[model samples]
Target: MLSRDRKWFLVIGIICAMIMTSISAWQPQTANAASPSASKVDAVLVVDVSNSMNTSDPGKIGNEAMKMFIDMLSTQNDKVGIVAYTDVVQREKALLNITSEADKQELKAFIDGLNRGAYTDTSVGVKEAIRILQDGKTAGHAPMIVMLADGNNDFNKTTGRTESQSEQDMAKAVAEAKNSGVPIYTIGLNADGKLNKNKLADIAQQTSGKSFITSSADDLPNILSEIFASNLKLKVVPLQSITANGNYQDVTVTVPNDSVLEANISIMSSKPVDARLIDPSGNTKPIPSSDVLLSKSKSYSLIKLLKPVAGDWKLQVKGVRQDQIDINLVFNYDLELKLDAPPAQSYKKGDSVQIRSYLTSNNQQFQDQELYANMNAVLKVKDLDSGTTNEVSLTNAGDAFTGSYTIPDEHDYELSVRAEEKSFYRETQPITISAKAGAGSGTNTGTTQTAAPAEKSNLLPLILAGLGLLVLLIAAFFIWKAVKKANRGFVGQIVLEIRDENTGEKTYPQYKKLNTFRGKFNLHQLLQLAPEFSGTDKVVFTPANQDRIMVRSTPEITIEKSGRAVDTGSGLELKNGDRLTIPLASVDKTILLEFISVNS
Candidate 1:
């Protein structure tokens, strides 16, 4: 009976050991427990059907290139839609739809059958794209617009319309999208190779987007890829600040996040310098800060629920790595943010005004980040006139940034972009764009306005004239005195002489009395222009080459000094007569000298 009981005990012990081993092996990763959430990306593709695209004869063939790009998109796993436009806008049968085996097959067929012929109505196409997107029921990531075209806008020409008119229509579409938060990308195909580059480029840049020119169909994809690269967003945010006794602090970091993001999140930065945070117990503890992935490169913070319950803390990130390596940034942004609308505000031509505030932000993680930060939008605008403002980001350091505005047309407008969060930053300079034009009738009856500022004008000639008049009066007086003093032939000398102490010689030279001297002169007493001298120890001169009359307590007639110099930030500056004067006792020559203007 005792032997049987011992056997049972050993068997139970073995069973318990096996269970413990299995539990340890299956433990979850605690390090990734708290991480930031990811968001979405919305991209819209707009293709051109202008007459130029119809000709595929090898001379800058963008017509076929558009189809090629569409083919590439057919392969991408991005949320996209398509639009085609000529004098008016149109969408294919499978326009905005979910990407699926059947959907993609249809998309492929549509692209393959595309033919270019109608005039390019760039603005109208953008309008239709925005409308389709805004009205769509499915909400995902930020919305973006991409367009490819090669021709002057004929929408305005055929309708007897102006860019201002187009802008008005575009403005409506853009406004809807802005409320949605969309960014746009534009490609101008100058097949004739002579499109208005400056105008088209400005339109693209205004959207915080880039414009690419492809002379061949094959190179279009490469250019589009570059635009994709620009879509990447990067930022560094202090996760949480904490305080502890004796100045120790805690901090967490939030890196840039993306929508439908891909690629490993990485950083080249100085190692975390004792980053810490305060716990609920009021004790300071270190917070891990390093070159670690936030949401595995998908979200802003690696840790989702980082809260500093106690103290004061700060975070730091250098642009480069320790050992001073160039920062390597590689990541993709998930795009999705509601575009509210394009700027609907307008002003008179040459009036200083601002468009409107626009923004985008992280939607999935917005619940927490909304209280602290956000992002700015990119745009594409056409028909800007005088005093046009270029689109610029107010802050790249953090997500909250502002945008600039410009004046171009007096009508409806269109702006396209990828969707994003747009916010105003206190430190970021305020976006202000305004223009002042003559109060006259012209095409631009519309303008954006701001507070009035003084105009700049040239006044150089007026200043010079004032100076010349004064100089003439002084010269005429001197000439009259010379005439009264002596006969015309003898009056020519007007006697000017100097005494030399070293050689004890008096030299007198014949001089010509001035007929006239002109221009404004400085006031006799009001203006005293003398410069202070410093670092003069370098000055030195040979005594044998000097005269004693030029010195104190000596019979000198010339005050020649050494070659000391002074330094200013720009370089040494000198005046003809700058000195510390000393009185002279006597002179060898007792001849009378004339004062026909000492400066003369």
Candidate 2:
């Protein structure tokens, strides 16, 4: 009996050895079928088992769903494995490859043994799982990493390293997997104890997987099924179709990027469907080396948004599609552009002013559908001088177009606007706008405006005689005893020698002159000075006779003008030691000289 038992044991051992060898060299290959998948898929589930999960609802749901999923995959399998994470990989084990019945039973044992743990280091767990998938010699298989966490990645930073270092290390591991075309599926269990929908969405989106914000434990199974099936099958909705040899139109394809996996959908057009693709950066790319044949039934079309940086992109399709697509394809797209005008400006009654407008595009470039559109845009100005209207063009720059108009003596104005491109279709609709006459009333136009009869000169001009009043208000203070003043320069000039009653001075009129290099001096500006300081309402200077000062200067000077003066009569002047307070003051050194017409 002992001999017989030994003989039987040796036979069983031999059989077991054979099985192990085959699995270790599984060399799993894709099975050829009628409808074959693009690649062989191998997925891993990295589950969280932290203490918080003990009290969280998602954890409970995750646990239950995983139990059932493990059983299902264990029996009907593909290349699958599981990793439970918590403070570290908590399963007392690493990875379970259940390719055969014996292995399936062992997996069941492992799952049954995973009791809840105390804490979680999601980052570490994830990093470990990724390492396994990356290390295993399972070439040709489309690899996937599914990691679940109940909260933020709060793993302790590596000792002696900066936070950035830790992040880099974590990122390094992820990058390695990505470089190998291994997509990581992130499942955020959330702190809400339920699933955090928004956070879950980000995880699913980032990893090319699926996300679920469950309200209860029951919803987990359905969500898990969905995530797994995301890769198994893709549902495409034909929102709209384009002409035969043309590009796709607003094809908003939604394939979960959580796995870092993307697919290319194609349509063949019967003719040259020229495709112009525009990215978020306003960059344009025409599909290279490929052309659409003008065959009514044999055109090929495809759009692949690969190496896709995460974000919404606008794809402008041009050309045609083959009739086999069963699409109601429209051959064109609208080219819509927009113009943004600045805030409105206005002027006082009777003031005519010049205004400006700017332009930009609402849609990038020109849409094929709108190719035949008329190149005209409408710019309507309200409260403007009647008969002021302009027709702009979208074919031109919207911003730099600068549409200018006049606001004539109007208190205010409104600007109405819309860009119109009429062709096969109304490229874009019009938008109403309002601007209050941007600029109005030119310089001095306001200063010289009609003023109500000057308040009856409260003080009459003094007619006192016997002092040949040398009121000598030398407008230009710098003195040059009249050696020259041309047009006013001294080729030869005359002056009346007068006297001052107060000081019995001016005995000899101190002639103020210009030390100029005598020529046809078109010197528009001269003597620019300011006291270095000023007040909003402080009196600057007052001339003796006139109500206000007369600022004079030549025209056509490239440089800016400066300084101001006023009548010093009534003791109201800017001169030092004068007790009288001046009337008004301004900081801006600009003063306008007006031609007081003799008719006035």
Candidate 3:
């Protein structure tokens, strides 16, 4: 039996443990904490396929723009879907996770095969796109919907859907998208001078997206480029216009920094032009090679270079003699903005706090002065009690953006930072601060004094409840420890082989020894050894019993065994000598894992 002192000490220890556990459980997971290199996006393209589009867009430039958008996406694990709608949904393609060149080709083929239909319902297209995102979007991915329309609602009475009904539906869908934090970008073609610009602008504004109006379908590609850049927080830089003389013309494009994941060089011309790239090392890189991908349409040529070296690279373009060619480069950087903590730990009404924000990429500060020249930063503050938000501009002060915000009222407030340019925007996660009542607010000393006795009386029940929870936690800890020990003998190594589904080529078998790891073993830890498997960081394995291991994976990873799809949601079990094939839906590769047991 323990003495009174020891009993009190044990009780204090349990209480501290309970408090720590509760704090851990209550803290929210934030996207800002993640490395910018792991950025992933899920997008849906909603196209208007009404027959009227044929008159507004005689050259089918909208289709070409859609294809260009697809080519612009260079990151792995980015998923895209399509919805072509008129009076009803005429054609729909579910979100296809981009894994390889083959998947991109599949999407382009779908766009090329689009057929126009009679009647128009803008709401139908937006609604379908939102539904697809809601159903297929992955966690931690930025979601967006791009709707290209040529006309407003012209509902057909035969379909029994009225114009008023369409408007109602559109409003409902827009509200749903805004609530879910999904932005809807709208592009209106005013070739006929009849495009409903007001409607498009309203939708974009309400959903925190941008609106574009083009008088000529020829401008579709550039507008789409802006939309893509803005949605992904990238910047578009234009190069000097060139007059191609039917020969290779030297044009210089400077990659700003190492943070750029992809540099998309878009050449806009009336006809297709040939392009060649010479990297900073003076090596002539092959077009459509492993590092370079080129997509050409009737009006534009787009070249995407993956992880281009940070320096001046020369691009040579050959076009028809005396033809005018416009060049633009969009840089997709893996970057995030970080807002510094307040100088003071606590605050009261009328207290002023200085705000400092900086940009980061790959967990390192980015202070490229040239890039900062074209950007603007702002501080966004929200009053938690009133649910109102205000933005204050932050001036560039050398390496960081600086501003100040004064506590206006006694309430909890959230502060964040945003950096933007004409073509792109990026924001940081918000930090909350509480401002309490101060001297001028009111008299509160007597109220606080009267509540002390009631607060003391409530302490006993809270302590008793904590003690009960501590007892249960102790029992659970011992049970978990016992189970962990019992499964310790099931040590094994996994034989892994990577296969490209498109090429039908298999890599040599590799071995990863799963030694003693507490709780669960993460397969992503082993996959991280290879740069190609960078996006799959959530797959985990746990020991189920002495002879079997439980497999837990993200939805993007499709598992199969014995020619049947394994229900990963219900918990997949892998026994000794079991062979499993896991196909990552985001990339064009499959992993083959064979568990081989070894004695401990």
Candidate 4:
């Protein structure tokens, strides 16, 4: 009915209208897809019930506080489990397996009925907690462990093992928790002089958890309330390297409004830098040296903020000394890649090295989604020296991605892990291997030549030489006696006999010179001078006087002076045969520092 040009125009108009309608219909679906659902939290409460707790927790205040904490877990989909530990660990409730509020009363009743035991083995409790969480972890739930301890670990007493052995066991367990991606929240109650706040804090920080120290038992309820009500969420930003240009390097993060944000800037270098936080309002707050909490091994530093102002927050780092310093900026989020290699990084030729990689996101094991047919999820290892690459296929091994490779030759290799459809990439430091020692060649047996006959009798010369040797010995003895007396007059040196806790094998004795006995010296600083002391923090040595030393420790640590536990605030006077036993958290054996008189 219309002309040719009008007909064409009408058809084009209809097509345009249809296209607009289609887009309008897709807009809401797109937005809904982008919105994230609320995440559920699964928590485990590890309570200490050692004999000391009976007195420290008078009137069962701890029990009451825990009951109150359980009551506060009435959120929509919160799940919790209870674990009690003394000489052994026991799971009081398995409610963490499901998201339910029906068992809340039962969990509370169990806490109220907990009794004290003979000794405290914190490691066992933590391990049990990890096992439960790992077995029951689901997609939408985040796993966490909350440990409450009132005294030091006394598991060694029950097992008849050395304190160092117990500490090593505990350290291993904590490492396991870290690898499993479980955040550990440690609470030191009535710890004023009893609990080791530093150790507890270290455990928490390593797993992106928090440490709380409260002198009053009554405050536990309030603290627990705040921890739950805040609903902490983490957002991580990976920064591989930051060069020291003597200028302020800025890292910006957009934080949600009215949220508590703690920024942990881990600088993996020996050089220390000046760090500060800049708010969107342009207000700068410098992180002071005193405020920076150094890890036991001095490997990392953490700075916490209670309630951070919302908006763009910038972390400025200045005065970096290294050329290319490795830095990691962890925001509300915590993510870590646990790489396991042989204890000895260097391996012999023809040896196979098993490399394991575990990736944890927000304290939950991350599994790659099958979004594509060809996932390309592989852990790639390359021989840097030989320029050969090996792509090892990684299967989801429950908590980690694992693969193994045999070294083709003696060369250095680097590792890079790719997973989650290549969305995650982690490049690790290089590892080197050396050629194995070959068999020794047959020993040569050269012809033995007869010695020439001794010159005819030199009796007169021999007699004269003997007289000179006697005179020298007489003079040397007198000089040594005088030197010994001088050394005894002042504490010339202290001998530390380092031993392996696991094997009970003693290494060479380490010596430290005390130029003056009156001056104050930190035992921690002195121990750092020894290579064996590397990666060991929480070494407490307080010298009360020239003759006496005070060994003070927090929960899970014991310093034996002359085979006896040193009382807090008391000093052990150095007697002629006295020895100080220091338990290290990093190794298996206790360090016995014997006061050896130079004269003796």
Q: lDDT by residue for model 3 over 264-350, one digit each (tens)?
A: 888888876888899998999999899898888777888999998899999999998998898988877777788877644357888
TM per prediction: 0.32, 0.31, 0.66, 0.34
The alpha-carbon deviation from the true structure for residue 5 of candidate 4, after best TM-score superposition, in angstroms, is 65
lDDT of each: 0.38, 0.39, 0.77, 0.55
Pick the winner on lDDT between candidates 2 and 4.
4
Candidate 3: regions farther than 4 A off: 1-23, 26-39, 154-156, 215-217, 343-345, 366-376, 383-398, 402-404, 408-411, 420-425, 438-600
> How would the candidate models be sorted by TM-score, starting from the highest?
3, 4, 1, 2
Please list the Cα RMSD from the true structure of every candidate, rounded to 1 decimal place: 38.4, 41.1, 13.3, 33.4
Among the numbered candidates, top TM-score falls to 3
lDDT of 2 by residue, 282-312 (tens): 5654554122111111223445443343344
- Score candidate 3 by TM-score against the native: 0.66
TM-score comparison, 1 vs 2, better candidate: 1
lDDT of 3 at 408: 88
lDDT of 4 by residue, 1-600 (tens): 346687567555544544454444433221001112233577778888888776655555556556545543433456677778875763244433323333555566567656676877667677777866764555556678888876377754545866676678778878888887788888777734577778788888888788887755435533553454333232233454677787778867554434222444454444566667776799776554332322211222334443456677787767555545555443432233445544345555676666666545444544533222323347677777778887888766655667776767666666555543221233333344333344221121321112112221333344445555655654675577566545532443466667787887776445565556433454555575566664334444434334344444454556676467775444445532346787876667677775533221
lDDT of 1 by residue, 356-475 (tens): 332333333232244225544444343334333334333322332234444454533333333233211111112212223333332232422211121111233333444455456446
